[model samples]
Target: MQTLEGMIAPKFSLKNEVGEIISLDNFAGKKYVVLYFYPKDSTTSCTTEACDFRDSHEAFTALNAVILGVSADDEKAHTKFIKKYGLPFSLLIDDTHEVSEAYGVWRLKKMFGKEFMGIERSTFLIDPTGTVIKEWRKIKVGGHVEEALDTLKKL
Candidate 1:
């Protein structure tokens, strides 16, 4: 993946669960963004990571940050996952993987001894001015949200 710090985050306009347009620009000039890329929705690790973020959403908001999740899943799938998990934040559907490639999170992975292309769980914190303040790649779900929150506070 490319180093994105000190660089402007790639702007994208994608559909959310309700098919509403959600753009990287939407939160610009107003709030910090927690732009996260995950392999899929509702998977064990993804679920844990998302729930952790959801649980700590108030703290994130208090820090003037908004969480936005991204995956190759479509709007329908995102809706199902959000409903099933009660995810508080919007899940952006990146069906074409354009945004994923721009962020450099889509990569080759080996799981169960099988190689495949997938998203590497990663999070990027973009400041209000659109510059990336921090990024966490190949994230482990445990205590990760708190760490991200702490980073946001510092920013």
Candidate 2:
């Protein structure tokens, strides 16, 4: 809930779309990690954001950054979403919501006068050293990828 910038990122190992386990340590000292937490897969905003990342995948790779999406979606759903959108990045499955809690993105949200617990849609930019360098909480999908990309450019 507080600023994670300059702090060591929360270490995690979760299953990706293909059922491969992925850990934050995997990117440490290798590439900057763009770990983004979304609400769900195949939803309108999520799909648009994922597609945006897909479109700019090359630029991020060229900058030595790996984009990882996280949500409570299961492996099957993630795989389908990736296949449908042709996502070029790994989408970590946070089925237990532990990772979201660690990152402080899991909180009470209201929609249509109904309150419920869900992800707030956040993104953390972790440098190769595993320190969180930049973060955006309660993110709006529009122009968000560009904002994240620009921040990485500064680093």
Candidate 3:
């Protein structure tokens, strides 16, 4: 994967669960963007990660951060997942995998001895200036939200 730290995040405008267009520029000078890419919605790991973020939503908001989850899932799926989990943030649809490819999170993977293309669970912390300040690739879900919060605290 390519390094994105210290570089301006690739621009993207995707529809959220409510079909509202959300662009990288929307938060450009206001909030730090936590752009996380997961393989799918409603899966085991994805649910955990999303819940973790949901549980810490206020903490992130206090620090001027906005969490935006991305996946190839459609709006209906995203809407269901968010409502089921009471997620306070937006889940963007990247149904074409265009944003995933730009972020270098779309890749070939092997599961059950079969290879396929999918998202590698990853997170990018983009500051209000739009520069990616930190990134975690192929990440474990446990304690990740806290880690991201801690990084923001240190900043």
Candidate 4:
């Protein structure tokens, strides 16, 4: 896998829960981006992570940071997930997994004794200048949002 810290984040444009086109360029020079890639929508761990981010949304916004969740799930799934969880931030549709691939989060994995390709839980913190300042891969959901928030506070 390639290291992303201290490097420019890969650019991407994809539909959000509302079917609105969202791009990395949209937040450039405006806010720090917490770009997170997860395995699926509405799954246990995914939901926990999303809700954690949602609960901390205001804090992140106050710090000039925007949270964006990405998954291979489509817009409909994202919409349901967002509405069900009352998520304030956008959940992006990464149907092609291209964005995931660029971020080095898409990979081969094993579950239930079977091997498959999927997204590895990951997060990237990108500064307003578009450079990735920190990255977390294969992350556990517990306390993850707080960790990200702490990192942003020190920035």
TM-score of 1: 0.96
Q: Give the TM-score of candidate 2.
A: 0.99
* Model 3 lDDT tens row, 109-139: 9999999999999999999999999999999
Angstrom error at residue 145, model 3: 1.0
Of candidates 4 and 1, the better by TM-score: 4
Tell me the tens digit of each residue's lDDT in model 4 across 14-67: 999888999999998899999999999999999999999999999999999999
Which parts of model 2 are misplaced by more than 4 Å? Answer: none
Local lDDT at 7 for model 1: 96
Residue-by-residue lDDT tens digits, candidate 1, 64-138: 999999999888888899899888999998888889889999899998999998889999999999999899999
Per-candidate TM-score against the hidden true structure? 0.96, 0.99, 0.98, 0.98
lDDT tens per residue, model 2, 40-130: 9999999999999999999999999999999999999999999999999999999899999999999999999999999999999999999
Q: Which candidate would rank higher by TM-score, 1 or 2?
A: 2
Ranking by lDDT, best first?
Answer: 3, 2, 4, 1
Could you list the CA RMSD of all candidates, in the order they appear? 0.9, 0.6, 0.6, 0.6
Give lDDT per model, in order. 0.91, 0.95, 0.95, 0.95
Query: Distance (Å) between predicted and true CA of 38, model 2?
Result: 0.3
